[model samples]
Target: MTAVIENTAGQGTNTGRSFEEIAEIIGQVEDQSRVGVCLDTCHSFAAGYDLRTPESYRQVTADFDRIIGFGRLCGMHLNDAKGELSCHLDRHAPIGDGHLGLEAFRNVLTDPRIDNIPLILETPDDTRWAAEIALLKQMAL
Candidate 1:
């Protein structure tokens, strides 16, 4: 099973608001090898892990690797955020159309670390899925 962390709404009481907390939850699982994480881009950004720049992306992924282990990265939810960094809002915008921008999606779609995993698009408009998928496929090239 995979654990998909939810947004904390900037409140202090929620779990899985940070990478450390997610790691903690994963750590407590009995069979770690069978479990993994489904990282939602919007939620991660809302929780304050910036993916808007290459440097920030590297830092954030490195922190995840260190804390949660890349082997546990099973899936990804590709969505843009409507809020600013650390805003803690769960709002999901269409791909390449929110605060995350197209570049961030480009970088992520091309990353080999997640090559075989599922990349689910949770963008707002169902009509845009084909175009968005095409765009992401192009970005992977």
Candidate 2:
């Protein structure tokens, strides 16, 4: 089972706000091997974990690896944030059109560490999903 971390800024509860928190929750599970995390790019960025540039991406991902083993990353929600860095907003823009440019998506899509998991899109505007998917596929190759 995979647990998708939710944003805590807008919400009253403080569940899954950081990698440490998520890791702690997963660690408590009886079968941690079967439980994994689903990272949402928008929510993460909104929570202050930047994934835009290579250096920032590396640092943030390293932090994630240190806190919540990369092997436990089972899935991802690929979405650009409409809010600025550390804005604490849950708004999701279409891939490449928001604060997180196409480069961010490119970085994640091409990363070998997360190559095996599914990348689900949570961007707004259902009409542009086809185009977004196509664009991401193109980037993946």
Question: Candidate 2 residues 11-83, lDDT tens each?
Answer: 3465787888887787788877677778889888888888888888999899988998888777889899899
Question: Which candidate should be chosen as best, given TM-score against the real structure?
Answer: 1
Which runs in model 2 stand beyond 4 Å of their true positions? Answer: 1-11
CA RMSD for every model? 1.9, 1.9
lDDT of 2 at 93: 92
- Which parts of model 1 are misplaced by more than 4 Å? 1-12
lDDT of 2 at 11: 33
lDDT (tens digit, per residue) of candidate 1 on 10-96: 545678878788878777888777677788899888898888888889898899899888887778899998988888888899987
TM-score of each: 0.91, 0.90
- How does candidate 2 score on lDDT? 0.82
Instruction: Give one clash count per candidate, in the order shown.
Output: 0, 0
